[model samples]
Target: MTKIIDGKAVAKKVNDQTAEAVTELVAQGVQPGIAVIIVGEDPASQIYVRNKNRKALKLGMHSVVRQLPVTTTQEELLAIIAEYNADRSIHGILVQSPLPKQINEPLITRAIDPKKDVDGFHPENVGKLITNYPGHYPVANTPRGIMTMLKEYNVELAGKTAVVIGRSTIVGKPMAALLTNANATVTLAHSRTRHLKAVAKTADILVVATGITHLINGADIKPGATVIDVGMDRDENGKLTGDVDFDSAQDVAGLITPVPGGVGPMTIATLMQTTVELAKWSDAK
Candidate 1:
């Protein structure tokens, strides 16, 4: 049987490290603060924000949540973000995604100060990622989480064939950039790609983020491959699962990350780590 990657356990390890960093920052007379703004009452977004807030508080960090009505205007939202941007206590700012129909998400993202764009969604951060310079922008948490897992597992990416199955800006594109930065030969595949399975089977490392549960199986993976499932899907019965068929892929792969205990927890942990890092940077100045 393939070794299962315990993301929950690993996330704890990451958080432990981040807790120490937070302590150090607090000792320097600076408290790390994260502001999360949700435009509408999206159930999933609310759940995510709640979990993040609880985790932040647990680690002695300041957690702020801003909830706006569904009918709130773009100007009103921007005004709120500007307040956080100017607030010296707030070190990291993340506006929960999928803003209401009337609001412009891109404009709001751009309005966030580059130093405080912890989600790495702003154009400034995006450009830094495309140019292979992570220092120029804040790195997205999901990609950073994946990289953190790989490092903890002692997985070497240099010259390895890494395939990312998605194209979304949040996960797919950023993941590919991160893998390439690690010296991996990366391929970004999408739905329209011809011979998808054949291409998928060529990778030493495979990351699925299509959000389609069980879309990939053993036939699409190489023997002894390392599979990273970045999907969170609900079945007809509302059971959460991932993009890859864990049972079948585990039989063929050397290592695999499960659905619930895999990538999800790590994303939040990475976000907290980034917040602490940003706070430390501010304190140093």
Candidate 2:
């Protein structure tokens, strides 16, 4: 039987553990605090921020969301970030992406204190990640969650051939670094990669994150390979689907993640967990 990876169940376990950690912090006279800043009223961004805030509160942490207008000036945003950065109460700070064109994304990312950058887009964290050394720098949440899933499933990466499809800095680049750091031979495939299917079929562990719906199917997978699909797209009939065709790939995969119930929940769960970690790190200093 193909073992189906249940992300919701895994997310629950992660959140439960985080709740325990939060309790310990509270007992130590500290409450984990996170500030989520969203530049505009993007429906998807609003939904994500609400979920994160709710989860943080449920875990007994302080959660604040700063909703800024789309026309908010760059100086206005930076000043707000500076306020959060200096506030000892806020241990983690995340700025929702897709900022307005007038605002420089990199400039804003660099403005936040690296220690409180829970989103892990800051160059300091990115450099630490690329070094592949042992450190406490935070990483992209989706990749961090996927790595947690691999460990929970007892999937060995040492000496394994791992292939990651997509080269987005948010997920793909960090994911490849993590697997490589764990001793896997990692290959990152992008849109321009030649013989993509042939490259994909050679992996013992395969992760597909290309936004295209149904980009990979059973034929692209090696028999008994572990597959993780990170794409959340809508098919022609408006049904939710992942990058890999689950219906066919499930037959060939040893273990696989589903569209709605797989990697999605883990992302938010990781955000909660990392927020708690940042709180602990701050307390230590």
Candidate 3:
């Protein structure tokens, strides 16, 4: 029988640990704090920010949300980031994505202080992750959460084969690097790859992050492989779905993560966990 990976349960465990850490930090006169900056009225981004803020507060940490108007200029945004960078109380700083076209996204990412780059998009942090550098640096939460779920389920990584089906900085690249660091042979595939299904079938572990809904089905998966779906997409019925067709994939795979309940909760929980770590690291410095 195939076993389902319970991401929600794993996330709860992470949140519980984070809460305890926060309490300990508070007792030591260090309250872990995060500042999230959202630059537009995008419905999805607003919902994400609200959820993040609510979770942080619930975890007994300090949370700040800075909502900027859609017409805000790049210079204006940089100034706000500088303000947060100088704020000793803020341990983690995140600027929500999909900023207005006039804003230079990469430049904005570079502007945030490396220590406070909780999203781990900054080149400095990314370099650390890619190099498997020995240090406490924030990593992209979604992929990091997946790693946590893998560990919670006792999924072995050393000497395994992993195929990640997206190349975006947020999930794919970091994920491949992480698996590589864990001694898993990783293939970072993308839209242009030939014989994609064949390539996918060779992996002992697979992570599908491409936004295309139901892109991978049972035939594309190796039998008994562990499949992690990182896509959040709408199906024909306008309902939430993932890159892998869960129903079929589950029948063939030994381990699988379901949409809506799989990777989503873990991402937010890992974000909170990273914030606490950033605070702890800052305190030590």
Candidate 4:
């Protein structure tokens, strides 16, 4: 029987631990705090911000949502980030993606203090990840969350053949780095790769993050492989789906994650976890 990776259950476990940590930190007079800045009124971004805020509060941490106008300039955003970087109370700072065309996204990412970079997109943090640096530093939550899930399921990583089919900063690059750090021989593939499915079939673990819906099917997956799909896309009927065809891929894969209940929940949960860790690290300094 193919085991479905229950991300919700694992996320609940993480959230529970985070709630306890928050209580302990409160007793120590240190509250984990996160400040999320959303540039525009993009419905999806607004929803994501709201969810993060609610989760932080529910976990007994301080949460702030800074809503900025669509016309907010790059300089204006950098100023806000600077304010948070110096604020002792805020442990994490996240600027939501899809910024206005006039804003330089990379500049905003660089502006956040490395210690408080919850999204972990800053060059310093990315370098730490690539170098597999020692000590604690935040990582990109989505891929970090996937790693958490993999550990929870006891999926073997050392010496395994892993393939990650996305190269974005958010998921692909970090994920491949992580797998490599875990001793997995990883292949990072993208849309342009020739014979993509053939490359996928050789993996003991396959992560599909390309946005194209149902891009990976049964034939593409190795039997008994662990398949992680990171795509949340719309099908022809306007329904939520992933890059891998769950219906077909499930039958061939040994382990798989569902679209709604899988990687989505873990991302927010891990963000909350990272916030608490940041607070603890800050207090130690």
Give per-residue CA lDDT, model 1, range 39-104, as digits (tens): 889999999989999999999999999988999999999999999998989989999988888998
Candidate 3 residue-wise lDDT at 179 = 98
**For residues 15-41, could you state the per-residue lDDT of candidate 2 as single tens digits?**
999999999999998899999999988
Structure candidate 1, residue pairs in collision: none
Per-prediction TM-score: 0.97, 0.97, 0.99, 0.99
Give candidate 3's error at residue 171 in angstroms. Answer: 0.4
- List the global CA lDDT of all models: 0.90, 0.93, 0.96, 0.95
As a TM-score, model 3 comes out at 0.99
Query: How many backbone clashes can be found in candidate 4?
Result: 0
TM-score of 4: 0.99
Against the true structure, what is every candidate's RMSD? 1.3, 1.1, 0.9, 0.9
- lDDT, model 1: 0.90
lDDT of 2: 0.93
Give the CA lDDT, 0 to 100, for residue 281 in model 1.
70
Better of 1 and 2 by lDDT: 2
**3 versus 4: better lDDT goes to:** 3
lDDT of 4 at 259: 95
Task: Give me the displacement of residue 237 in model 1, in angstroms.
Answer: 2.1
